[model samples]
Target: MPEHSDLGLLVLPEAVCLAEALCDLDWRRYVAMVELNFDLTQFYDHVAHRLGQPRMFARSIAWNRDGDPLRRWVMAHCGRHKQTRNQYWDRVRRHQLPLVHSGR
Candidate 1:
């Protein structure tokens, strides 16, 4: 991951919401949107429109580095990690297994 000097640009709560919304999109739609947008500005505009936040723009909440905290959070919370974690919890519940947090 690349370092970011402007780590504070994105608001955590808003970025989390955006990540969740992205995760909720069907794979095809996600791909289509990515294909259509030429840049992050256009992408953000489409996302903001979908999210009904017309005022939201890339400038207000942008990630300038590969190691942006928002990017890390989205990766951990929105994709394969989320799917696997959900599957694990579902199986645990089905088996009536007790959950033990290791406090990572």
Candidate 2:
């Protein structure tokens, strides 16, 4: 969530959330990812710096246009990721305060 504002940026790549997989999968494949600091103060800072509360998680594309996804399954997983993200958004809408925005 953005600090002192309701507006927040949800930057999904191909419209998918990327946090839940933070600890589950190896991120070697996702070269196009913009991750902020992986600490406490930095976490609050990321949220505070935003224009408003982050109602949804977003991923700024860290991959270059030339970065190739080696497998078709990778692309397919991204699609599923998008669907999962939309569900997350719906859950957030049901609440008031923002949840912890998981880190890199």
Candidate 3:
């Protein structure tokens, strides 16, 4: 069969699984851990899709699983500075996204 070189394709689980595999490859490496930063934002950059909600579940926690356990992925220096996730959560709280809503 002839191949259509003009056609393009994209997939999610493959990219996700590949990123996760990279994490597995270098679980202890700083680059593989926190600095890798695999999330919806990065996904959009890679796969060009709009993932609306539940990024936590959508994104595999490979980074956090392998990242520095002693740190909170945020600044631990007496609240001196904030992390990117902190800023995102603050924006979410300001907008009432309710990512952690309890079943009532």
Query: Quick one: best lDDT, which candidate?
Result: 1
Clash list (residue pairs), candidate 2: 1-53, 1-54, 2-52, 2-53, 11-59, 32-62, 32-63, 33-62
Candidate 1's displacement at residue 66, Å, is 6.5
TM-score of 2: 0.27
When summed lDDT is taken over every stretch of 10 residues in candidate 2, the lowest stretch is 31-40
- Taking the candidates one at a time, how many backbone clashes does each contain? 0, 8, 0
Question: Residue-wise lDDT of candidate 3 within 1-94, one digit each (tens)?
Answer: 6677665776687557545533443332322223324422343222222233355533433234554422232223214323654675577667
lDDT against the true structure, per candidate, is 0.51, 0.38, 0.40
Winner of 1 and 2 under lDDT: 1
Clashing pairs in 1: none
What TM-scores do the predictions have? Answer: 0.27, 0.27, 0.20
Greater-TM-score candidate between 1 and 3: 1
Model 1, 1-104: lDDT tens digits are 76867667655676676666567656324433332123335545555665667644443434445555533443444353445556765776779966688989
Q: After superposition, how far is residue 64 of candidate 3 from its true place, in Å?
A: 13
lDDT of 2 by residue, 1-104 (tens): 65686667867642222233322244522322212222222322333234343423212212223433322333445555665556665666768676688795
Cα RMSDs, all models: 16.8, 21.4, 15.2
